[model samples]
Target chain A: MELFTPDSGLVIWMFISFAILFIILAVFAWPAIMKGIAERANFIDKGVEYAQEAKSQLDGAREEARGIIDEARRQQADILRDADKMKTRIVEEARVAAQTEASKVMDQAKESISQAQKEAEKNLRNEVSAFALEIAQKVVRNQLKDEKSQKELVETLMGDMK
Target chain B: MHQRLFRYMVVIMACMILPVFALRGEDLAGNSAAAHEEDKPIDVKEIIFEHLGDGYGWEVPFNHHKRIPLPVVVKGSDGKWHVFSSGKITDHQDYTEDGVTFRLAKEGEHKNKIVEVDALGNETRVTDMSVTKNVCAIFLTMVVIMGLCFWLKSWYKRNGYKVPRRGLGAFEALIEFVYNGVIKSTLKDKAEKFAPYLLTVFMFIFVLNIMGLMVVFPGGANVTGNIAVTLVLAIFTFCFTNFFGTKHYWKEIFWPDVPLWLKFPIPIMQLIEIFGMFTKPAALTVRLFANMMGGHMIVIVLTLLIFIFASFGPIVIGATSVVSVVFSVFMLLVDVLVSFIQAYVFTMLSTIFIALAQESGHEEKHEKKEDAGGGAKEAAAVTTL
Candidate 1:
């Protein structure tokens, strides 16, 4: 009945008890416990498979998005380049037309100026010649007025003229 | 028929020869003088030691009240001394063989002791000790069981079988049960590493405990009722706990930190905790040993009541026998439950102790984090107000 007695026989019995208990547990309870563990493992394995599938899908979507972005960028670059080329062509065409119109107007102005100058010059010459004939007739009339003296003067004038 | 006959003959011969061979080489020097004239024949239960007259020797005597083996010393035909006890023989022939000769005394006579002669041709009084038959039986049982387990395990492995069908299946199941219930419950991450020890401890205790039950039930054998067996097991646990215990565990036990106000009392608390550590395993040892021994004592006492009333009447004997049987059956059931529970408790406690020892630092870190979080929450509430 004493506690903590160093009874050697009890030691032997303890060993025996331990051995038998181990055997019983090993046989029956162990399998059930292992079944639980196996089920857990299967659950984890399924989770891992789902995660892998999700990862692969995400990667595929990312790749598709990247492809779309690249395509959009290429189209953008083409549109911008076309716009630049059209702007340059429009500006060059406008500059050429403006130059051509200005030159045509200048040529017309030069031709009209030359014609007007020639007419003005002819008129001036006729007017000056008439003026000069009138002056000369006036002088001749004055001199013939003195006709009486004119026969003699005419003779002198004809002589002087000769 | 010949083989059967040969086996019978062999058994008969063994029966005859075993006692004779066992009796041979026992030292009978001191007891022979006392046993010369006997009122009753002295039953020599055990022989402790033997020595030649030229040197010193000693022997201890015991009575055969219980069926356990008493330590025995013997000298073999090689003129050497040997000690037989605990199912093992330690040969001292290298030192004693040159100077001694040994022989068996008479068997039928009351003088069943070994006689040793020294180099001077003088008869020397030496002790004759022999290992007990029960001890030998227990030892043989252990070896056979272990061998069978190993063989089955190997065979299963070699055959590429998934699990054992019969005996091996039982063993694997027990292992897994301990692994999950005791090891996994007590140890979180490193259960597998500790599984073997836990399983071994559980199985060992359980088998022995059940053996104790068997001893009283039908084919009764008081194996676990013996103290020496329990002591060895306890010692094994003690050594294992100490050896595998983490440094942090020992530190916590010896130098635990307490609040500043309780600093003076910390030493006392630490002392108690240290004592607690020792007591845990000690409790394991005593709980198992007491339960087994208590059940056995009760059954024996109950059966003894029949003998006390033997002279009264047949009716009394019959009644007592019936009562004893009924009580013993009840006790057997209890013992069975105790066997499994004690094994589980021991393994679980040991695993928990190891786990605690190994992970105290982590627990402390977690606690500190919680405390800090609480403090931060309090500060945030104050600021919000």
Candidate 2:
């Protein structure tokens, strides 16, 4: 028996079959495959959009929080300044009122001491005048007595002479 | 202009060299003009099978055996018909007006022979023809299958049916399976570009593999069981691998920057790795070829046993036929799985090669590693200081 040999026709047929197979696949199968891929791409794009939106929202919230904190700090400082001003005004007013009250008290004390001194000087002078009058009265009485004595002595001399 | 010129010169050289080699080869084979005369009447047989004569030849699968035949039909000057088989041309002597002349060369009587003829009407006989029925059947089956596929495709297209149904539908499903499962997965970025070629490879191998398993059925050809087809496929892959390879891929293969100590060994290892790249596809070819061939061989061997034990009578033939049928069916199921697997394997490997060729490197990962290394080095230097 002779050995078997493949015909060139078979090889040609193989090539033809291969070509036909490729055409059929390109037409029918490719679309579905691409569709699935496109879907996956769309999913990724959506995910990225969501992430971006979230980041923007987070930044907006942070800015809002910062603004609130700054406003609160300003309000607190304003309150402290007003309280300090009110405290200083009250102290000044009190100091002025106290000074006026003290000066009034001092003037009243001086007036009372001057009135007492004047009254004491008048009383002392009157007392001294009464005493002087009393002494003068006593002296006049003595002197009159002495003058009588002298008159007596003079009278005795006169008697002796008579 | 220089490249074109060079290419043209190469083509011219090839064209010139090919014919010279062919003529030299023919002369060395001791082919003679007189021997050509003896092969005249056999020319009629040439018309029966197109592409099966003259210097043209193809390898065929035949019951676990592959054969190459170069059937020549030569007409003698004396107006006689002679059939010169591949190796045997002198078996049938030239019946001349003078007497019968015998050409003696090589071994074998009427079986497996070759014929040689010299000048001055001398002839040499060499028997070396091993044409079997199985081989003819295989050849015929291949032709018929190809014709059927063409007719069906054309018919379907002409009818203007929007969607494929029946035969076309099944074929379309197979295409989708390969495209989605193998090509898309392996060649993620460029699967679309490579889909058509990869799909073609998948379907071609798949159909041939399925046919290989159809031996139990009448009129089946085991084409995939032949190694030549697989070798051709492998060569295509090898060419594609190198042709489509990117600079980065080649850099990794050739000038890999391994550590200084490992650099010498690495190149040697890379040489092996480069060799391995070719061997991978070669192994793919050989594996598919061997598996298909082995399965067919087993089936043929089983069937042959029935004939060998003919002395056991009709009962034995019946029992053996039943067993053979059962085993062939089992093998057929396994072959179906293998058909898809082999197709997938080929596509997968090809896609990986393409992916490797097109890879640009993971820049993000590389940058991250560099930053880490720099940070560590800075810390170490600070500590030293």
Candidate 3:
């Protein structure tokens, strides 16, 4: 029976102690602790948000960087292809110009050579005619002394003409 | 290697229990009918009850006759207050002062309590407001809690809400665990409003329960096992649950959304709701008290087994002592676990109760009608606590 009994002294003390503890803690401790905890929680939340924002911004920057690099590579490829085509065309044009100049030089050289050859042939023929005329004159003079030789030369020339 | 270690530990434990066995053998030798008052047969019931109950003084270890007395405050029959050390009355002697006599009653209904006697030799109770063992223990518990709470506060104050290091960090973890796990999850937005009381109760009960496990100074008082203490805690829960309860809570209790027949005529649901209200706190009170008291009682009973086996000679006494020590040690460890659990359960239940009261049924009505069943289920969950 005594075991079941609730002592007033202990009850009063317990109530007083509990109330005092609650009051003291509620006023001095709980609010501070709770406020500190809540503030920390809020701080962590903001930190996470900031980190995520920074990460997304970094990702965007990286994407932009990738885009810039791709554009530069594309421009470089186009410029390289254009430079290769220009090099090919320029080489082909130079080769064609050299071939035309060589051909024109060769034609001019052939014309000059033919002209020289013609001149030489003409001179040779004139010389030959002249020599023949002179030879005939000398023969006529020498043969005047001899009427038979002159007469024989004239008859041979007539027979050749017939 | 582990097995060897274990054998060594058992041997060491047996060595420790040997002295206790020798002491009990001496005690059993005086168990004859003509023995002295201190050598009387062991009263297991008295021992268990005494250990479970609050005392006017803290019992000294290994010395049943003497105790460290506390101050006794009582009002005499002469309508005046008397203050004295409890040792004066607990020494099996009557204390007389200013024409009034007070004595601690023995072998009667008022046994183990201070009673006032008059010229007619009739014993009547005094207004005892002593700072007994339990009260002192409460003060000790309060100081410890204050130390821990203020330590945490100072840590936060200095560090600006950062997680504290080491033991203080563990303490913070416990606080956060209870607050976030039980209170905040259950009470939702209203958690902050009632967190102070709930957190305090949790710490109060937890520290008291752990402190009760100690057999030495500052730890031996069974404060939590007392009915009065648990009742006060329960009453606080009841007050908080009812006083801060929302309008919807009261409406649900008096006029629930049950069938019309259950609400009217017989008023079956209403009665059950009212009954459920008291039952919540009642259950809280008894559950904590019984669990703690039972834990303490089992340990004491296990210890008494050595004395019970003393008549069987040294062999039986030695065997019983070893078994008893091992079991009691195990039981004490279990009690430590129970202490934390009971504290957690008490706080969890209180949170649920407050959460139940904080529910606003308007949401259920404004939303789909099917959710109303969920509300009733929630109420049922609270009653199960």
Off by over 4 Å in 2: A1-162, B1-162, B215-219, B364-385
User: For model 3, how big is the iRMS in angstroms?
Assistant: 1.0
- How would you encode candidate 3's per-residue C-alpha lDDT over A22-109 as one tens digit per residue? 9999999998888888899999999999999999999999999999999999999999999999999999999899889998898898
Model 1, B83-130: lDDT tens digits are 544222222222243445543333322123344545664444354334
Task: Identify the runs in model 1 with alpha carbons over 4 angstroms from their true place.
Answer: A1-162, B1-138, B159-161, B216-221, B260-266, B363-385
lDDT of 3 by residue, B206-269 (tens): 9999999999988988888898999889989999999999898899999998989999989899
Q: Each candidate's TM vs. the true structure? A: 0.47, 0.46, 0.85
Best by DockQ: 3
DockQ of each: 0.07, 0.04, 0.69
Error of 2 at A109 (Å): 96
Give the poorly placed runs of model 3, Cα more than 4 Å off. A55-93, A125-162, B1-11, B17-40, B259-268, B365-385
lDDT of 1 at B248: 65
